[model samples]
Target chain A: MNRCAVIGIGQTRHAAKRDDVSLAGLVREAALRALADAGLGFSDIDAVVIGKAPDTFEGVMMPELYLADALGAVGKPMMRVHTAGSVGGSTAIVAAHLVQAGVHKRVLTVAFEKQSESEAMWALSPKFPFQPPLLAGAGGYFAPLVRSYIRRSGAPPEVGIKVSVKDRKNALKNPYAHLLLPDISDEVVEKSPMLWDPIRYLETCPSSDGAAAMVLAAEDSLGGVTNPAWVLASEVRSEPTMFAGRDQVNPRAGRDCAKALYAGAGITEPRRQIDVAEVYVPFSWFEPMWMENLGFAPENEGWRLTLDGATSMTGDLPINPSGGVLSTNPIGASGMIRFAEAAMQVRGTAGAHQVDGAKIAMGHAYGGASQFFAMWLVGRDKP
Target chain B: MGEREIAIVSFAEVIVERSDRDDCELLLPVLKRALGDVGLTQQDIGFTVSGSSDFLGGRPFAFVMATDVLGAWPPIRESHVEMDGAFALYEAWVRLQHGDLDTALVFAFGRPSQGPLHDVMSLQLDPYYMAPLRPDALSLGALAARAALDAGLTSEDELARIAGERRGVPTSTSEPYLREPLRAHATPTLRDGAAAIVLAAGDGARALSKRPAWIRGLDHRIEPHSLGARSLTRSVSTEQAARGAGALGFGADVAELHARFAHEEPLLSRALELPASTRVNPSGGALAQDPVMVTGLCRLGHAARAVHEGAARAIAHATSGPCLQQNLVCTLEAR
Candidate 1:
């Protein structure tokens, strides 16, 4: 297999509504940035791989077909990936695999969600036959999982509050973050209205319109990129949505995905060996939940790490230095955003949110009742 | 660069006008047959991927429920594409090149009979431009047919003959026009179906099938989304993809094409530059039963089976989007 590296990264300035640009325009904004970052043009790309949460989110089925021209995919192989929320990460992995497989030299992968185009609340919870109406939206569905994690972990109620505050503070440093909470604090998060039991509105992610893109190249095709983030490993795993004894909070798929990723990257100790991470934490409590699932901490012990500031920028294994999904959740793009930020950290271009001297980082994304998971490990040095 | 050899060891599909069975039910038997044909089970597959669209099911994460067919209890390294099954096979092909996994199972399902397929398909058009117009599939197909006719590429009688040949009928059988130039017979029947294909690489493929369909070249290309921006008389994407897949090098004995509309047959034939002796739509093609997502891969399956059945070389084409906006060509041979 050929070595692959991330030579370019781009993201839109996430907002509640990007009315100025159409869906195609929204994607082009990120794709153009990525091409510019790589110092290449539309003609340089060999293929295009795109992903999004659902066609319902934009009321357009297989939007990539329509976006062929906008993304300069004419006369080029273009693929559309959809594995629920992990689609962004899954899409990136597909692009990298093309390069790794030596099928293409330079592949452009893009993921986006124009949530403003439709009501995701309705789209996500549409009534189906023989299925009970569990129309609580994303927050309601995850709130109980958060409640279960809290009860099982026995972490103080303040843990979720601290995560909300810290990520929001980190968002202030990210110019492209959707929710720039300059005045964010734990007290403010605690005082916020409880949307779900023990899950405050502030603890949940906001619906935003944005896109994320990256240019993945075979090792030899790094035209002018001096510090490419080498793709050390990537993995995707999935299980049925419901089965006997299935743990939703800490899914087996998530664990297996992380295990494969770590093993592939030759890192047995993720907490000590990894320098930074950008994990999909749509809900603030997912920080600890996923930390445990990813083996960054032991079961029920993940909260302790968060409580001890072990996931903070100045602490060990800083997580979500780009403020994560909670700060800018563009559903489809959320996963790719995590992957891109991880690549940025290793490239030493994360700006204010950069983890100083970060050499190795991990990006993760999960979707659909947490049954699907995708993760990748990137390092500054060749793996 | 020469790619690692991959072959289709087994293929199975079921096409019906409409089925009481759900997507999972439609897929289970097909998958079982495909796996059994190769003397393997779900566990034997190293990677799994599927292609499907949720909009057809009128719900999100519809493909999630289809996983029940895979018996994903212990979990599996799987992924999905919101496309036709042929594209999923393309992904599996790419995955096999990693050299870690030797076998992969690919499947796709769609039920066009359950929804307003024409309107639903319009949703695939440019949301800001074409979708707002709500142009139905037949009218769009008619527009392309008219373009070809006006460009002197084909005649009305040729389309009728193409449609007749696919239906095993004669053009003398008069059919009413659904759209100005497009007769009812020219349009494909809406079908509900699923298809499964097992792909194995190198020695594993040889071990699986005595007559494996060796994929020599596989490539897909897309065109601009706007119908007005393109010349409907020609399939540039098909030409590009056929060239990429090396289909233009000479000709194959048969070419199973995913031409949902009659006019597309000639367009693709010209694009791929198939010889006159090349048999087109031997299994009646998509016109016999166009099950949306499944039809494309079914074309591929049929073409692979032709090679497995003694044909020296064959070509399979799968198309997505309106007016052949995107096309994938795969050339297979028995060696």
Candidate 2:
């Protein structure tokens, strides 16, 4: 693969509702910021790739086509990617390839979701003759998984609340993160309205109207960048939605993506080498669940890390320093936010939320009954 | 950087014909054959990627059921693109180039029958501008054809000849005009089909087949979605795709095109720089078959099969999106 690096990253100020702008306008804000961050204009991009969940969520079909002009995709190679919840991560992977394949340099990738514009729950309505309606948002789907993780791993309940408080508090440092709760407390998290039994309201991610963008380039395109996160490695994996005795709580696909990513980045000890990480944890408990899945901590002891404050921004290794999807989730863009946040950490451009002395970071995302996974490791040093 | 060879170790595709299979059933078997032909199972694949569109199927996440039949046990690495499978294949190819995985399975499905496809597809245009006008896909193609006609790029008679001889249906007034400038014969028939191809790297390539259709170059580009912004008579994107695919400076043995319209054949051919002697659409091309999203990939596969079977040496060309709004070109050779 051709050498590639993340020279610029931008994200919209996530909110419950952004009625001031249309969906296209919401995305262009982020794209323009990213291009500005790279000291380039939209015309500098050679291609554009969009990532979003099902078209039903937004009532738009293949929006990259309709959005061509706003993203400066005129006469360019434009594509749209969808993979249930993991679309944002996968969308970035596709854009990275444009540069990696030597087909285009300085490719722009963006992912967005405007859930406030429509009722996503009804949009996620059960398809005829498949799974019956669980009437569960992502939190409902993962609460059982979180319960299973708690039971299988024997993690205490407080671990989840702690993460919830931690992320909301971290959101204060992020101007673009939705649900800014600077004074977030465990009591506030525990007392919030509970949508699902095990998953408290604060523990669950918000349905945000937001977008994220990144400018990926070949190594040569990085001349003026103050700091850039080189693509140490990227990997994506998937497994059957339901087979005999599938592991939905801590899926093997997530594990495989982690192992492959770590291997490619040449990091044998993830916990020791990775200084920061931004993981897709739609539910707070997923921080521990994915920590185990991503090999950042031992399977059963991942909760202890959170309990010990080992996963906090001030911890030895901070995770989700940008408040995480649990704080701001636009579904499609949530995964890319993780990827971009990780890139930001390594690039030393994380602003107020920067992980001090961070040289290596990892981004992880999963979707679809825990069947799809996309992960990447970025480093300050070029690999 | 170093050369990392990739191969189409296994391949599968349903014929570009009207199918009675349900959306899931119609798509599942094509993927099953692709994995089976390579003597591999879903578990053998490290990554999975798919291509498809919801508009074509009248339901969103239309490609989701593919995971059920693909045996996504224990969860697998997966992604999907809302485009043709050819681009999905390109994404898989890039994954392999990064040396993270050696083998991958790429698949795509579309059933044009599931909805009022042309009317639904018009939604892909700018909603505020084009959708307000209700510019159906037929009218768009007709608009492009009219531009060609006005430019003397082709004639209605020539278009009919290409449609009749190659497409098996020539333009006729009897069929009634769906759009004013487009004749019934020149427009491609609405179709339903699925396709899949297996990609492998290096030794995995050699192990898959005696004659692997090694992809020398592959790429795709898109013109703007607006009709007013582009010169519909010629495809600058197709030419760029061909140039990036490294297929033509001079010539090739064959050019299997995916043009759905009669005039589009000449339009795309001139863009790709196909020699006059080069055999074009020997297998009757998209004129004989087109399964919407699957047609572009089927064309590439047709040319690849031709090369694999010793029917051609080097093959090039592809068509996708509205009025060839997007184009892909790949050179394949027996190795």
Candidate 3:
């Protein structure tokens, strides 16, 4: 297989409403920026791969057809991936595979969610025939999982608040981040209204309109890029949404995916070998939950890493230095942002949020009741 | 492009006018049959990918529930596409090229009967310009048929004959038109259906079937979305994909095309440039049983089946979008 590298990355400035641009304009902004970053044009791309959470979110079925012209995909192979919230990460992996499989030299992958176009909460909580109504939305569905994690790990209520504040503070450094909470503090998060039991309003991700894009190319296709983030390993694993012995708090798919990724990348200890990580933490508590799931910490002790400040920007292994989903969540693009931010970190182009001397990084995303998981390891050196 | 030699080992499908079963229920039997045909189980498969759309059921994340059919206890390497199953097969083929995996499972399901499929398909158009007009799929097809007639690419009588031949009915052009140039017989018979295919690579493919449909070349391409921007009388994407898939002069014994509208048959045939000896749609084609998402996959399955059954070579075509805006062409040979 040919080695694939991230040559360029771009993202939109996330906001509650980007009504100034149409859907085509929203995606073109990121695609153009990514092309500019690569110092190439639409004619250079061999294919286009796009992903989104669901068509219901945008009320457009298979929007890639309409978006072909906007993305300069005319006369090129264009694919649409939908794996729920992890779609963005999966989409990138698909694009990388195109290059790795030697089918295409350079592939453009984009993921976006114009949540301002429609109510995602309503789209997510649909009541099918003979099924009970889902009246509580995503936060409500996940609040119980957070409650279960707290019970199983014995984590204090303050851990979630700390993570919320930490990520928001990191967001202040990211110009494209949606929520720039300059005065984010534990007291403020604690005083916020409780949307769900054991889940505060400040602990959840906000609905933002944004798009993320990346240009992945084979080793030979890196024209003028000097700091391309070489893709070390990429993996996606999924399990049944519900089963008799499923572990919702720590899904087996996530564990298996991480195991495969580390093995492929030849990493024995993720916490030590990996310099930084950008994980999908839509809720603040997910940081700790996923840390354990990803084997960064021992079972039932992930919260200790949070309290010890090991995951902060200046800590030993900074997580989500680009603020993460908690600070800017465009459901479809959140995962790609995580992947793109990790690439930025390894390329040393993260500007203020750059982790010093970062050589290797990991990007993680999960969706569909945590049943689906996509992860990849990238490094400054070629694998 | 000598990547990896992949072939279709087995295929299974179910078609119904309207099924009360949910997506999982509709796919469980087909998945089981596809696995059983190759003497393998879900665990033995290296990767799994599916293509489906959420708009069909008016629900979000509808494909997640379909995973139950696999009994994925240890979890599996899986992915999905909001497209026809033929594209999902394309993804699986790419995954197998990594050399770590030997086999992959691809499937697709759709229940267009639950709602108005034509109206639902209109939403796939440009949201700002086309969707507001609510031009149903049939009307768009009519526009293409009119363009084809005006360009002298095909005649209304020829479309009627093609529709009659595909539907196994007698040709009668005197019938009243459904949309001027297009008659009721010129359209596909919509249905709810599901399809699954098992693919194996190299020696693995040889061990599974007596004769594997080795995929020599596979390619898909897209064209502009605006109807006015493209030549409706011809499918430029189809012609490009055919060239990329190396099917231009590679004469095949059979060709299976996912031509939902009867008028698309000649258009695709012209794009593919098939020899007069090549038999097209021996399995009745989409005009017989058109299952929104599964139709394209079924064409591939039928083409592969011809190779498995003794044909020397075959080519399969799958199309998407209005006026065949996107097309996938796969050339399979029995070697």
Best-fitting candidate, scored by lDDT: 3
Candidate 1 accuracy as TM-score: 0.98
Q: Compute the lDDT for candidate 1.
A: 0.91
Candidate 2 chain B worst ten-residue window by lDDT: B169-178
Residue B300, model 2: Cα distance from true site in angstroms: 0.7
In candidate 3, what are the lDDT values of residues B138-240, reduced to their tens digit?
9999989888889888898899888888889886889988887888899989999999999999999999999999999999999999998998888899999
- Cα-based lDDT at residue A20, candidate 2: 89
Span of 10 residues, lowest total lDDT, candidate 3 chain B: B65-74
TM-score of each: 0.98, 0.93, 0.99
Instruction: Identify the candidate with maximal DockQ.
Output: 3
Lowest summed lDDT window (length 10), candidate 1 chain B? B168-177
Q: Tens digits of per-residue lDDT for model 2 on A292-318?
A: 888878878889889999999889879
Number of the predicted model whose TM-score against the real structure is largest: 3
Interface CA RMSD of each prediction in angstroms? 1.2, 2.6, 0.8
Error of 3 at A41 (Å): 0.6
Residue pairs in clash, model 3:
none
Candidate 1 lDDT tens digits, B1-335: 23889999899999888989888889999999999998998888889999999888778888987766688767789999999999999999999999999999999999987889987888888888788999988889999988888988887888888888898877643667889788888888889999999999999999999999999999999998898888788899899888888899657999999998888899999999999989998999977789899898998899999988998899999999999999999999998
Tens digit per residue, CA lDDT, model 3, A1-383: 89999999999988999999888998999999999999999999999999999998889999999999999999999999999989999999999999999999999999999998899887888777644345677886788889999999999989999999999999999999999888888999999998887879999999999999999999999999999999999999999877667898999999999999999999999999999999999989999999999999999999999999999998888999999999998899988999999999999999999999999999999998888999999999998
Off by over 4 Å in 1: A130-133, B170-173
List DockQ for all candidates.
0.79, 0.53, 0.88
